[model samples]
Target: MNGIELIVIAIAMYAVAYKLYGNFLIKRLEVNNSNPTPSHTMNDGVDYCPAKPPVLLGHHFASIAGAGPIVGPVIAAGFGWVPVYLWILFGAVFIGGVHDFSSIISSVRHQSKSIGFIIQTYIGESGKKLFLLFSWATLILVIAVFTIIVADTFTHIPSSGTSSILFILLAIAFGLAIYRFKVSLTIGTIVGVILLFLCIFAGNYFPIQLNALTWQLILFAYIFLASVTPVWILLQPRDYLNSFFLYALMIGGLVGVFFAAPSINIPAFSSFSLDKVGYLFPALFVTVACGAISGFHSLVGSGTTAKQLDKESDARLVGYGGMLIEGLLAVLSLTAVASMVNKEFIDILVNKGPVPAFSLGVARFLNAIPFLNISSEAGQTFSALAVSAFALTSLDTAARLARFMFQEFFEVKENPEKESIFQNRFVATGITVAIGAALTFSGQTMSIWPVFGSANQLLAALALLALTAWIAYLRKGILFVMIPMLFMFAVTLTSLGMLVITNYNSENYTLSVISLLLFLLAVSLGFKTYNVLVNGKETSRELI
Candidate 1:
């Protein structure tokens, strides 16, 4: 099949899903524009504030569509384009989009509560604690890995490093201008774009050359501060500003795909080999988790996006619509990798990192644009910076969510009269950063990340279950969420079991133990949720 055909088909699928299934979801959820969102009702400006749909959409997309989709699809291409494409198509429509859409609406309905707290409300108090701890740990691992990824990108390519620094400063300035100085969005955005261009040139001329470890330390410190600050002050404005770069990357790649008209050079399938890419059933599911269905999307949906949503109507656009867009990105990444890249480049991507593979493929695509005059080197650098922007945008959002999880874990709100040091935002964010930093430097994180797929999918299953419960409480049919939840639970559990066996055989008992514990926890929670569902009993008044 031709690469252009693949892209066209993928686009068609996404459009059809968005119009038909997405509309179905919006109708079924009974989204009402008349209802005031938590952002308006609880306008705190720090954590809760009404945001325009465009601005919130930028933040939502930037937060959820990280490098995971690119990396996962590129690597999973080992199983062939057919399997990956099929999963990305159907999974995004039936599973991922549903998960993201339901998560946001569910949280909005619950007054912008975190999924962990929602789990507690629908399940049990213990369920809440367990879910929060599990989610917090996962966020730490996510932060550590993404931190290292960005820092390593900067350490190797000093130009991107400089651009990233300038990018942050621009975000802060944009935040202050809009929030503090009352500047119009149009002016703030214009200035941000100009500064971003300057950032590119300035980075090329004067780059910051630091080792990966040093960059990691510096980034962790920045995250510590960004996490505790108000969302509008840093996270929202930064993400909104950084989104332009991502938008450019996506547009450029799409134009490249259209004009380049590349062919699918890679094999259609790998004959279903475990040694090559593991069993296709569970491994394929986990490997392609992000583009298809990611639990992390649920976190972002419920974490900050719900809090800032201006109206219930926007949830469809921001949640369901965002996942479909991400699915398209995954398709584009896979198309580029399979058609434009070679075996040697694939090996480097597998062994080193997926960034180079994506950059090179993007470079090839952009090379076809005659008027752009984009050289191979220039395209590679641009793609790298764009990917780095995605990772860096996600970093602080994850940290802030982790801080919220920490506060919930400590029951900080149970008694508003007394102050607890641990409940302080700074203290919570500090702990989150410290744990993530320690993990980043531990050297075990690289080994542990493989299990991340299972853990992440497990989280998604749990999120789906939570959403299912919420729908059940509303007395709506939950067949949509329930089917996916059962499938994900089985797939993730199987993947976790496989990881346990794989680790034990390799004598990596530490990871084996950790995976086993996670497996057990997921199973236990699954069982509890099942018991509640079957018995038709509500244990917590929080749900009512």
Candidate 2:
């Protein structure tokens, strides 16, 4: 198929899955409630209040659709478009969407709690501890890699400093407009997004230069403030606004691809091309997580999203449908990367990272469009900047999630007595900064990349098993969840084991060995979790 036709087919498949499989999951699971009581029903205008569907969607999509959708597809395209397309369609519809929907629905039935809590309740105490530890460690890796990614993008040229500053100011202004002025969130978001685009142009006009150390310090300060501030004031507004930029960039790339109508020059498959590094199976799974499936979505579904859900039925729309949209984005991104020539493709893979390479492909596609007159340099800059924006959005979400995990792990009760919510926000901010600092300082950080992909896929396999067990226990259809869960478990385990053996043979001794060991630990824990859930005595309260 041609580029545009391939994209259309993928999107149509996603729509069918959303309507048929998504609906079936909801019905079979009996997620409908006659008198639906979302966790946000008790929302005291704080963390647990009913947000409008649009605002809630904006928040959820922004949080979930991070650098993964961009980075993974581009990197995977190195193998070929066939694998990338197949994995995204199958993975997103069956695996990613299922994990997302189940998580949100499960959290709503309980209270708006973290997935760790749900695992603890349903899986067993040991399961809970293991999941939480893995979550914390994985999140740390996410924050580290994404932080460097953001830093790299923002510092690509001396001028990006202005764009960074402008974004921070716009976030603050957007926050105040909503919180203090009581403006409609949608209206505020529109203005904030417009201003963000203006800032991009402003970056070109009024460039700022700063030393790397100075830039790091400034970025740290901005993130600290952003984390501590109220969601309405900064977090929600910034993310909501940034979502528009992300969508625009994505849409623009898609339009460019279609208009250019670039031919797919790469072969459907390459002969076990091991020169790029990493095993194909695990690497493919890892690179395609957001497009296919991701454990992180479960956390988001349970953490903040379940609360805002106005109705149980909305889970299909917000969770499953939203994932389908992300899947489309992945397909579009992959197509853009695939359209590039082999030499240009390898150059991008080697020099500017996967995201930048993908952007370069998009730019090349856009340059082919009639009447656009986009320059190569300009397209490259736009691609880089757009990536920086999206990557930062992901980093922002990860920082918040990490903070939540840290607090939960410490068992810090949500007490109003010790400090105001804003004070607690400051604590969260501090934790985020500390995470960034540690990642920045550690010279051993690069090793995180090789194993991060598999580690994430491993987490997805574990979550699927846990969710499937819970559903079966709840008297839902076991066949659908069971067979798929087993398949994923086997695939992930085999892939992870291969990765370990490969790394061991390479003997580039570092913390990667630690990551391999963690994968093994996850496997053992998974078996134990399955055994306990199957044979253990039932309790009134679920325990992970």
Candidate 3:
């Protein structure tokens, strides 16, 4: 099939899932109810706050949909399009969307707490702590890896002085408009997006060019400040504005696929090869998680999303339906990579440059539009900037999440009780900045990417197991969850084991071995917790 056809198929699949499963099954299951109030109910008109549906959707989408969807598929195209396409559709509908929707619903029904808190209540405290620790460790890796990615993308741009200045100005204006002027979020976002595009255009007129090192330093500084600041002042406003970039990216990708009409020539299944950097089974599952399904989404779903859900009924559409849209994004990304000739695609991959390849593909579409001349170089630069924007947004979200995880882990109590909330927020932000700084200095962030896919997949497996056990305990069916959970667990464990052995032989094994061992330990704990749940033992809730 051609690229356009694949995109159409993906959209149709998502639409059907939204209608039949999201709307119908959600109502049938009686999952729509507004009883259990979210725990973090207090709102200060910013973070930890309730919001209207549109704004909440924007926030959720920006946080959950990141470079994962784009980068994963592009990387997976090394295997072929068929596996990428299949995994996205099936995984998004059955695994990813279900996990996201159920997590949000569970949180809403139990007071909007983090997933760890809810696990404590339903599974046991031990289970909760284990999950939280695993989650926290995973989040730190996420923040570290994404920070490096953004830095790399920014530094890759030809040192145009105008772009850097414009970006800083845009950020300042965006920060003030939302935090000081109290402008409507929607309006501020629109203005910020417009200004960002203008900066890109104005970049061409600048005589000054930035070097890679300078861009890196500047970006690190920006991240440091952004991490410590309040969400309203920077993170939220920036993410809100950046959503437009994601939208434009999606549009560009879709249009490219449609006009190019490139056919998928990769076989339905490639030889089972382990010699490649990323193998198929587990890697495919991990790489495609954000687009199809992600345990990370549960973090966002239970963390901030539950608090802002205006009504219980919105959960299906916002949670499940939204995931499907992300799945479509993955599909489009896959189509773009798949459409390229094998030799051309390999050259791009060998160059270690996704932006250039993506832009070249996009230029083909632009050229198809008569009189619209988009040079390959210009397209490449645009792609680079877009990618940089994507990486930055992901970094911000991941940093915030890491902060949340740290605070939850340390459980540092606030004095005078009333100050507890503020204390928690402050501590979390501090932790985020510290981690970001460490990662920037160490330069070990990219090393973590190889394991990122597996770690994330493992988290999803654990979450599904917990959710399934909870449902079964509540007299719901368990088989549906059990089958996939076991499959993913096996796949992830195998991959983790392979990574451990490879690292061990290389004589650089401390962190990798530790991570592998910890994952195994978690697996053991998860099984013990599962047995307790299934047997209906009089267990202390703290064991979770």
Among the numbered candidates, top lDDT falls to: 1
Root-mean-square deviation of candidate 3: 4.1
TM-score of 1: 0.95
Rank the candidate models, highest TM-score first. 1, 2, 3
lDDT of 1 by residue, 1-544 (tens): 8878988898898898888998889877898889889999988878898887878888999998878888888888877789999999999999999999999999998888888878887777788889999999999999999898889888888988888888888888888898789899998888888888789999999999999888998999889888877898788988887778878888888889888899887778865754645888888888887778999999999989999999998988899888988898898889888885467655866676677888888888898888898998989888878888889988888999898888878874467347577778889998899999889888878888878888999999999988877777777777888899999999988888988998899999988998999999988888878777777654332322
Model 3 lDDT tens row, 243-298? 66667767766776666677875555565452445667666776677887777888
Please give, for residues 193-276, the per-residue lDDT of candidate 2 as tens digits. Answer: 778889989998988766666766666676666555555556666666777777776777778878888888666676445465
Clashing pairs in 1: none
Provide backbone clash counts, one per model.
0, 12, 17
Give lDDT per model, in order: 0.86, 0.72, 0.68
Best by TM-score: 1
